[model samples]
Target: MNTGGKFSDAELMEAIQKNEGKNDAIRFLYQEYFDSLSSLITYNSGSTEDAQDIFQEVIVSFVQIVQDGKFRGESSIKTFLYALARNTWLNELKRRGRMTQRNKLYEEGRDRFAVPPSEAFENREIRKQLLAAVGRLGESCRKILALFYYEGQSMKEILEQTSYENDQVVRNKKYKCLKQLADLINNDKIIAENLKQIDHEQGF
Candidate 1:
């Protein structure tokens, strides 16, 4: 009955299914994941309490998968947990109607399918840069880009919202806005300096 052996996740899952070793197994999971998940949630605009709630929900989903024999072996347990937690948080944000592009990008990065670490990092950085660039755009351009990309609005929809006379006008405005945003990212030396400071502080 020594439950201290480092059981493979499969062994622990079997015990969980049998209802004989769930507490110890779950305890191990809590001790292992609580802090990391808390940091992730907090960084994604959640409070500590929100983090706890999401982590509990994640545990419930994980348990359900184990009980129902749906724990596929294609992804590692860590990847599965991250995906479930991220999606749970994103759903919470959507329910509140406060889904930010940053949050959307983060969940997209955490997706278990079709993402490698390098690409994920690159995507995350690019999104951050893009957001900063958007912040610098004029109000009209900013609104246009937000409507077009964030709201998934078509050119006609954008024309109506922006009071543009035609689809061609809206399309041209979008192109200029995108170019301005790109230029902002390129010309904003402050961001580059801040990045250097961050790298130095992080010892990277």
Candidate 2:
């Protein structure tokens, strides 16, 4: 079950689960699938950068599915991934206030493999809004927040990875970044509306 760097379905699942052939597996997945997935996003009124983010979300979802023993191999991994990417993008469009029938149009004639969509790794609406707020930050704060929050690195790990002087400094920077993000969120009417909508949905 070896040809160049492509993994068979079984090998892909094993590589993701065991972390041994993981790097090669991921690299091959990206090399083989990024373009097609990204094109799907771009064709659906999203930008190139949006495509990148959607693909990253797709990969995160796929990896989680593999790790959690949810990938039952009823379909090939490629088909599963494509369906997952499509569903993930559809979810994003709905979140952005788009209620288009184009999603139905796209799904109408596809051989949507039996593998279901998994959003286990996609950000919830609130967190996604906060990420947008964070994206509005300047370079340093963005990096700090990304390293600390998104990457889930420890303070010590971040200190080693970044150029901060010490833990206190890093904490201070993170605090400032959080405050700035809060201010940004507060200032955005759309984000505030989204928060309220989330709360309403949750019966808050």
Candidate 3:
């Protein structure tokens, strides 16, 4: 694995180009970029599992770029890799119905060289508080809410997965758990401030 960040761009490209040492090249890429890329997803309302999934897709894309012979060495591998990861994550957010208008505008303006700040909606403090609030809920509430909201599962699906009597039971639990979370946020002055900033920045 490329554990020491000692691999050069040309060497990386070459490694990917050649069949030999290909797995090593992939391992090297994972060793180098996984943590940062995973954090990018996790901080943007994604769970660790979601981050892992996104990074796997990013690796596939990185490999394809190299194999296609279009890498061009135009930028450092890290820059290109990051651009790919961020774009992929943003698209994932959109597919999950998590992207807001602010995210849309931000995506439109993103540079190939840098990820913009996550303040508009995916605020770090907001993420932190949300996780905390959810953690404070009972296990049933947490599981139900995560399934319905984060996992985007339907009430029927949730009913099948849980011990609920029916879809209505699942729906009621979700509503109450979400309400509890909203109350938590309402009580947290810092979270409220961060949310206000998000709306203001997004021109909402």
Q: Which candidate comes out best when scored by TM-score?
A: 2
Off by over 4 Å in 1: 112-204
Residue-by-residue lDDT tens digits, candidate 3, 97-136: 8787767765785564443344223464575577688788
Runs off by more than 4 Å, candidate 3: 1-5, 105-109, 112-204
Top lDDT prediction, candidate number: 2
Model with the higher TM-score, candidate 2 or 3: 2
Question: What count of clashes does model 1 give?
Answer: 0
**For every model shown, what is its TM-score relative to the native structure?**
0.52, 0.58, 0.50
Ranking by TM-score: 2, 1, 3
Candidate 3 scores a C-alpha RMSD against the true structure in Å of 13.2
lDDT of each: 0.74, 0.77, 0.76
Candidate 1 vs candidate 2: which has greater lDDT? 2
Q: Give lDDT tens digits, candidate 1, residues 1-204.
A: 227546567766777777667778787778878898878899999999999988987787678677777776577767777777776777678757898888878766656552233223323345456667777789999988888886688988888777788999889989998998878887867666656655676699
TM-score comparison, 1 vs 2, better candidate: 2
User: Model 2: which residue pairs collide?
Assistant: none
lDDT of 1: 0.74
